[model samples]
Each structure stands twice: as C-alpha cells, then as structure tokens.
Target: MRCGLVLVALLTLPVAAGRADEADDAFAKKLGAIVRDPRQSLWARVEAANMIGKIGPNAGAAAGDLIAVIERLRPTEQEPLQEAIVEALGQLGAPAKAALPAFTRLAGRTIDLDLALKQSRDAILNSSDSQEIDALARQLLSRDPSSRVRATKALSDLGPVARNAAPFLAIALGDADADVRRGAINAINRVTPNAKPTEAFVRAIAVDLRDPDANYRLLAVRALGRLGAPASIAVADIDALRSDPDPDVRRAVVDALNRIPIPQLPPGVTATNP
Candidate 1:
C-alpha cells in the first residue's frame, strides 16, 4: 500500500507540473500572436485580450502591446476590442499600474465617461495594492457627477477597502437623486459590514420602505439586514411585517430576520422579536 501511494504521487507530480508549464507557454504564445497579428479579426484580438486578463499579473509584459491597440482604435471603433483591453488591464493588476496615468488622461477626453468608469472600476478591483485602490477611489469621488455615481458603485464593489469614502457616501445618501442616494447607501453597507443604523437613517429607510417603488423598498430591506441586529428599526418593522397584508413584505421581513446575528443581540433579547 505504501509503495503504491509513493508510485502514484511520483507519477502525478511531473504530469501536473508539465500541464502547468504547457498552459503558461500556450498563454504566452497566444498573447504574442494577438499583439503581432494585424490581419487578425477584431473579435479574435478581443478574445485574446480576454484570455490574457484571465491569465492575471503574469501578462504584464503584454500591457504595452494592449495599450498600443487601444490607442489605435477610435472611441467608437470597436466595442468588443475596448472591453477586451479593459479586462486584460484588470487581469494584469499591479503590473498594469503604470497605465493609470494614460487611463486618467483618456478619461478626461471626449470618450464616454461611463465606459471609462467601468474600466477604472475594473482596475481598482484587480489592483493588489491598497494605495492604488485609495487613489482611484479618491479620483472617482472627485470626478463628474455621473462618474461619482459610478465610483460609488465601484467602491461598494471593492467592499471594506473603500472605507475612506464613508463620509462622502453618507452625504450621498441624502442626494436629490434617488439613484445617487441608493448608490451611497450601498457603499455605506459595503464599507461597514457590521454597521448599526443611526436612528435617523433607520427612520429614513423605513419611510423609503413604504415608497411606491417596490425596488426602493427591497433595497432598504437589504440594507437593514446588513446593519445587523442593532438595526432595531428594521427588526421591529419587519416583525410587524411578518403579519403584513402583503405577502411580499412578509417574505422580505422573514428573510431580513434570518440575516441578523443572534449572538450579537443584547442580553435578554430573544431570537424572536417581541
């Protein structure tokens, strides 16, 4: 039995190592072809770019080539090609940090801010460095209103690393635009995983919960869940909702209660709301 186990391990190691090397080599070759083949279809180049992004930081050397391709294409030239570049840059992570200045410049140009925001968010999420994320978050915060909205959404996507934007996000929670407020609330929830709702915010959310828009109420419920048990406003409201005339509200209330941490409840507090 021992001998068989040893034999199996020995046989598997070299084969696994060989497969890894083969994959790496194949990726390198495909990357080279994508950069060098002018006659390649735009879709093929885009596909190769997507593959490089999936390959991660090891594809750093391909950054220059990818940037060259991006520069050659007009803003409206090829959407697939542009998306591929964004994904590849994201995959490159810290190695692609050098491209940020260029990206910043391009973002300031006549190009679509929405698309630029998407790319920037991708880069921020893929970045290995916290400093890089901080810098990008700051830039996004200060950009145009539309970009700020996108940045807030991206920061939410980055989760706790975006804690720096909490103050700004809180301010956004009161924005005149409902969309902006929603985005801010989302960012706040992301940064404060164990967040406790302030009485005011809780009250405001409760009012939103009764808004004519079902989606707004749904988001408010989700935010309440993220706030944990101290979100008494949500707990009380949801408990009442358990017997609500509307089936949807009752279901939402049940789901919300399931998310609260029972152990975190104050002393004497039962798992069941009174």
Candidate 2:
C-alpha cells in the first residue's frame, strides 16, 4: 500500500504514479531531493525511489535522476534499493526507455532480479502494445519461467481492466517457479480484491493447498483468507487442511477460517454464539 504499486509484499511496492492518489510536482520534487542526496539514509533513499514510481509518468522528468541513483547503487547487491529503482522505472513506462541497456546489463543475476529488470524494461518499452495483451496473458502458463514472469507483471500492470487474464493468473499460483507463483498471486489479488473468487481461482488455490511444498500451502491459505467471502466455496477443503502437518499451514488455515464469515441463519434456527 505504501508504494501503491505492490499488494503482495513483493520486493518492490505497488506504484500509483498516475492513478489513485496521484503524485504531483511538489511531492516528486521532495522525493527527488532525497534520492539525489548522498547523505540520506538507505531506507529514505529506497522510499524516495519507490515514490518516484508511485509518481508514475509524472516522475518522467526525474528519470535521469532516478537513473543516477541506480548508477550509484547497482554495482553490488543493493537489494531494497535495486527493487525500488527498477519499480520506479516500471512506473515511468516508456519514458524510462533510456535505461533499457542498463537493465539488460543487470539481467541474469537471479530469477527475481532478472524478472524485475525484464518487467521494468518491458513496461518502459512495450507495455502499451494493446494487440499483444492476449498473447501476454496466455504466456502466463508458459513452461519458461521468464515468459511466465513477464506475463504476470504485464497483466498486473493492466490491473482490474485485465478481467480476461484473471483465470490464467489464478492458475499460475501453482507454478513451480516461486517467483512466478508469487507474482501471479499478486496480480490476482490486485485484479479482483472485491470481486467474487472465480471457480478457477478457487480451484487454483485448492491445488496449491495440496502441494507438497509448504510454501504453496501457506500462500494458498493466505490467499483464501484474502478472498474472504468468496473463498467460502473452498471451506470444506480448507477446513480439512486444519490438521495439516505444517504448523505454518495450520496457522494459515486458522487465519483463513477466521476470515470467511458464516452466513446468516434462518429465523426458525437456533444459533449459538461461540
């Protein structure tokens, strides 16, 4: 919520640069100052870098400055700062195209790092190619992790307007690549926070809940919790998971059960309070 860019606690937060609670001239100026100042604390710099993306295309004017900030930090594993800066470039879209070479140089570091760079680079270069939206959406199921990652971010960037892609994204929750799985989950949440969970969505989470990987079970439980009322469709299956051997999965199930509210009883029915 802080960046308005991410919702699933990805390395970088979500950006709202040109969307809700738009970032303005003065706000960008303040962040730019912090980003440019060598004396600033690392967290402050990270926050400033993120805000630039939240400022979206409005921060286009600061693209050079943001690039400078990246130049100052990218020589090593500057985790938080790298995420923030690349996320900022993603927000700026095509305006940050000048930094594509830098991103290209930065790719292949790690699955996460490479995906982040590719996402931002593509966002800045081809995200607006409307005709390709369908192709990208289908790509979410690609066996290639890179293709899946790109599709997830693209669909995510498209937001709720990407109604058509939601099912694919939901299915991606079970991807073997942890990064794709997480990115797909993030995209699904962002695209349908208030909508009923599609049957496909519920099925996808169900599959994850059965996964041998505890992480998938944990993520699926957390997803059911986030889906709230709509996720009640999986109540029986989720309830059965209460005894899951993994403590984390059990905790997640408890959290999910707490999240899905009970329906109202009939007037003739006697309801007892817990």
Candidate 3:
C-alpha cells in the first residue's frame, strides 16, 4: 500500500508543481508589465495576456492590469489584441469577473466582441473551483494595501461564493486607506449581495456613510443599496444622509434609499426604517 501511494504521489507531483510554478506572482507581474508596455510589439502584448491566462487562477491578480490594457486598446484599431485580452479573461474564469463590467460597456460594438463577452461571463459564473477563491481570501489579509485591493477586486468577481471572505472585507471597510476601503465596499456589494446582513456587518458599512471622504461615503451607500432588501437595516442611516454635504453622496444616499425595500417584520417587530 505504501509503495502504491508513493507511485501515485510521484505521478501527481509534476502536474501540481507545474501549476505552482506558474502561480508565481513575479512571473505573472512580468507578463502584466509586458502587456501594458506600449513600446512592446502588439503581438508581444497579446502573447503576454495569453501567457497570463494560461497561468490560470493564481494569475488572477493580473486581472485589473489586463483590464487597464483593454481600456487603453479598446478605442484603437487593435482588434486582435482586444480579442486576445478578452479570451485571456475568459481563461481566467471566475477570478476575471472584474472584467464583466468593462465587457458590458464594450458590448453592442460588434458580433465577435459580444460573443466573446458572453462566453467570458459564462466562464466566470460557471467556475466551481474553490482553490482560486481560497487564495484570494488569504491575500485579503495581506499587510500591503495594494495586495488587499487586488484580492478584493478578484473576490468581488466571485459572487456569492466569496461569502466566507465577508469578515475580512468588513474589517477592510474601515481600512485607513480610502482606496482599500472603497474596494472593500465594492467587494461586499458584489460578493455578498444576497447574504444575510448581520448587525455587525450592516453597522460596519453604515459607518462608511459618515466617512470623511465623500467618494467613500458614496461607494458605501451604493454597496448597501446593492444589497437590496437585505440591507434594510441601514435604511434609517442612509435616510439620514439625504442631506449630506456632498451632493454626489446625497444623491447616492437617495438612490440607495430607493433601492432598499421595506422588509417584512414579524408580528410586534417594528420596521428598522425611520
């Protein structure tokens, strides 16, 4: 039995090691840098994206970098590179969900582009692998804010499957860095839209409505709104922000209030809304 187990382990070791080697962030970052370097040949950039895609889940951190390249090339007549980037995002699967919004904007432009976008979206939603999700969740607690931001972006793309990372994201909502805080709320909205909003979670996000940065407040309100009826717990707080000093924040607050529906409470249980 021991010899048979040893044989099986040896058989699997190479394949596992190969994937681990590809997951190296340094390698993925180098490919991302190549994809973004304008001076590089067009084919070189396309190849770089293709390489990153081939790296699979571990290369998820490069999704934002690839999206930046896509945005820069979308207007130009670089159809081939655009297609390659889109294909790479599809290959990245669930980790590339962050690209769906960008693909939505690029839709209606052409048949090929639309089809590619649909395929990528399907791939992202159909992905069942938990390994990538686990890796990004660990990155959520990284000491570096940039790493946390990338993890949040990737986790947000995961839909309900990222529910386990909610606690980390909640803590991130209070991060000292505005960008990290913004990313955290964005992640919460996308990652746990249907999750039962706990008092602590709801309160953690509600605190953001009073954040010093107007943009953070606006994003927090939008995140809460995205929670739909589940976020009714924050309705009173959001309503109070209707007269916020920042016009955009106030506008978002009103829109959020509109989005949150009246929750059905038990008999004798009062509604949380004011």
What are the candidates' C-alpha RMSDs? Answer: 17.3, 17.6, 13.1
lDDT of 1 at 148: 67
Q: Find the candidate with the highest lDDT and give its number.
A: 3
Per-residue CA lDDT of candidate 1, range 31-104, in tens? 64564456766656666676667666665667777777666666666766766676677667776676665565
Ranking by TM-score: 2, 3, 1
lDDT of 3 by residue, 53-80 (tens): 7767677777888888777664546777
Misplaced by over 4 Å in model 3 are: 1-23, 128-274
| Clashes per candidate (backbone, < 3 Å) | 0, 10, 0
By summed lDDT, the worst window of 10 consecutive residues in model 1 runs over: 8-17
Question: Candidate 1, 142: how far from true, in Å?
Answer: 6.6
TM-score of each candidate structure, all chains considered together: 0.40, 0.42, 0.41
Question: Which of the two candidates, 1 or 3, achieves a greater TM-score against the reference?
Answer: 3
Best by TM-score: 2
Candidate 2 lDDT over residue span 47-160, tens digit each: 778777876777676677777766666556566777788889888886687887778666665677677887787787664444356787879867799989988888888777
- Candidate 1 vs candidate 2: the TM-score winner is 2
